[model samples]
Target: MLNVSNVSRVFGKKAAVDRISFTVDKPGFVGIIGRSGAGKSTFLRMMNRLTDATSGQIFVDGTDILALKGAAKRAWQGQCAMIFQQFNLVPRMDVASNVMHGVLNRRSTLATMFNLWSEADITRALSILDRLGIAEQAPKRAEALSGGQQQRVAIARALMQDPKIILADEPIASLDPMNAQIVMDALHRIHTEDGRMVIANLHTLDTARRYCDRVIGMRDGRIVFDGTPDLLTTSAARDIYGADASFSEAATSTSIDTLPRDQNYATTLLGA
Candidate 1:
């Protein structure tokens, strides 16, 4: 369970994340939506402890996260896996090696520096890549994969951590619409198959509605709406985007339904 109380992050005169509070007492898929600079990214960073909060507290399973130090803080970070907009893979390294690097935080620095991975770790990494439909690319350099395939590699690396929660900062924002669908489908499958909490920052309303069970809308560092996806109507989205009632929903939609009907397109595109 995750509980955030009055958490805020201020940058000079601006509060990137205001005194925002929310709770996730159950495993589910959550999507955070708003226009750019809505503090969606900052909130996720605070929860991951990448950014310290200016005030208030965050508790995960009843443990005060802000009070943890050193190894305890590192442990907390490990439990909360983060996926960034950029794939963040070592471009020159083979996919398997990059995936094994996920466990480097828990291993000896010297061992990792030499790339001395255990046979079991290698097997596990390959298993994760296979689960994401990229095991064949494990022997190839990270740079050789397509953008979407690279993102899958990134997800495999995150899964290598066996995190209790996954925080994705705009996981599909950089991909083509078809690839975006593929990546979102992978994330949705992970949530359903592992029963883990998945929180993602999404730029489009249709993507959120299609996959997330719950949606949280933030505007100017404050949550303007929080409820089921069905409740995220055009009017609610307008308020979240700070648009007048004349706002067109098309402006915030990615039009995912118009993508190619071929579900295997991602695989074919991978071979391009």
Candidate 2:
């Protein structure tokens, strides 16, 4: 389980993340929603310990995350995989090589720097690539693939880490609608089939409603709404995004209803 207790991050007069507290005990897909500068990304970064929290504590499965140091901290970071928005892959390296780097956090300095990956690691990388539906791309350069494919490769890299939790920061903000659905589907599959907890910082309400079992809305660095997608009503959305709720809903609907199975639900909740 993951426990966040009144965590906050302050920068001068601005609090990027306020005294927020939440917990995740089940394996499922979670979406963090908010407008830009709403601290969604900051919150995820804090959870991953990519940056430090200003105050309060974060614990994962009885371990004091904020208090951990050195090799222990590195190990924790490796286990909590992060998939970045920019598809952080080596442009020149082949896909398998890039995926192998995911294990570097747990590998020795000499072996990592020398790139002496064991056969087991190579096998693991191939399996992850195949599972993500990109086995053929393993031999290609990461830069050679399209944005959606690159993102899949990034997901593969995360899976290679064998993480219990996957944190995706704006994973699909740059993609077009079709690609966005594919990426979201892959994330959902990871949560359901592999039982890895998936948490994403999402930009659109419709996408969040479609893929996340739970939705969290943040504004000015604080959570304004927290509930299941079924309970995220129109009033709740307006409260979350204020006057821009309708506009956001319009954009989100035009973008996420590729198949329209939830068109009615989304339209009703979107208050369109």
Candidate 3:
């Protein structure tokens, strides 16, 4: 359903996303795993046109997204929703209102200005929150919620858009182990029940292996490996993080069920 062909992003002399190409088909989950600054986030941004590619093209449903502009570009972006590592919610707004913000592109300016979201739209937003197990927090201020609740709110907001594809950049990065599992479970349910295409940028090899059907590894802005998790051996991890004994050791220690999915925990422990 989504195709990226030879996409590259250069910042002056540095190439952030080098000649990468990948395709996501049907409702399956695909994970892009790599070390920090490995270009996973850049690749995700390019998919939604949040960042422009220096060369090559991206196609969604056979339309060239790279060439899209004006209404077309807005339409394409709306069709592919993004969830950042940071719970990008307006702190003062209610959770329901935050979710409703996802529908801004579909609503009239006057309607949005008046905050006059239709009852059905409101119901759908609440329903999505419920699906993510955050419906009870809908009336609460966004800042009052816990980190996990905030992340779930962010997911609900993305679902409110009725997007065909979801680009999640470390969606479970800040939560605890249980919360991370809950969030991953929500994403899994979305993929299985709703049949939406999901591409997630993950830090741990284990999360990629456990949740994603396919894994794409990046290093130095280039794709180093693209295959199933069962094929990702210790040597492959070494290839991606060569001479970095610490990284190799951590990768070796990663177990599909035991790896810490919490990015904050990993950062605090590994000093990454």
Candidate 4:
């Protein structure tokens, strides 16, 4: 279980995340939606311990992870893997090696520097890439793959960590509609099939509604709504996006319905 109690992050006098409390006692897909500067990224960063929280505690299975230091903190980070909008793989490295890098914290620096990965780790990385439908690309340089394929490589890297929870910060913000659907499907599959908890920072309401079991709406450093996706009505969206009375839902819609009617394109978006 993950419990965040009154967590806040202050940059000088401004709070990026302010006194927000939340709990996730079950394994499911959660989508955090808000405007560009709505603290969604900061909240996830705090959860991953990438940034220090100015106040309150974050507990995982009863231990206050926020208070952990050194090795203990590193252990916590290992269990909570993070993915980014910009597929943060080493572009110059081969895809398989980049996936193997997931276990760097568990190995000696000398071993990693010398590219001395164990056969078992190599097999595991290959298996993860295959599971994501990208094993054939493993021997290729990461920079050679398309953006969507690169993102899958990033996901494969995260899976190699064997993390209990995956935090994806804008996982598909840079992809086309078909690729976005493909990436979202992978995340949904991870939560449903592997039973690992997934918390994604999403931009489009349509994406969240389609993939997430629960939706959290944030605005100005605070959560304004938390409920099942079905409950995220237009009124709630207006509040989340800070739209006035005349605001059209189109402001936050990214539904593939707007895509071109090309046969191949439609088939791709439909996961054909």
Best by lDDT: 1
Name the best candidate (by TM-score).
1
Q: Model 3, residue 33: what's the lDDT?
A: 82
With a 3 Å backbone cut-off (N, CA, C), the pairs that clash in candidate 3 are: none
CA lDDT, candidate 1, residue 239: 85
* Candidate lDDT values, in order: 0.89, 0.84, 0.82, 0.87
| Range of the 10 consecutive residues with the lowest summed lDDT in candidate 4 | 261-270
Clashing pairs in 4: none
Q: List, residue by residue over 8-58, the lDDT tens digit for candidate 3.
A: 999999999999888866667988888889999998898899988899888
Model 3 regions more than 4 Å off = 243-246, 249-256, 259-272
> For residues 140-223, could you state the per-residue lDDT of candidate 2 as single tens digits?
999998888888889888888889899999998988776677677778878888999999999888888888999999989999
lDDT of 1: 0.89
The stretch of ten residues in a row with the least summed lDDT in candidate 1 is 260-269
lDDT-superior candidate, 3 or 4: 4
Question: What are the per-residue Cα lDDT tens digits for candidate 1 across 241-269?
Answer: 98863463677778565664336744744
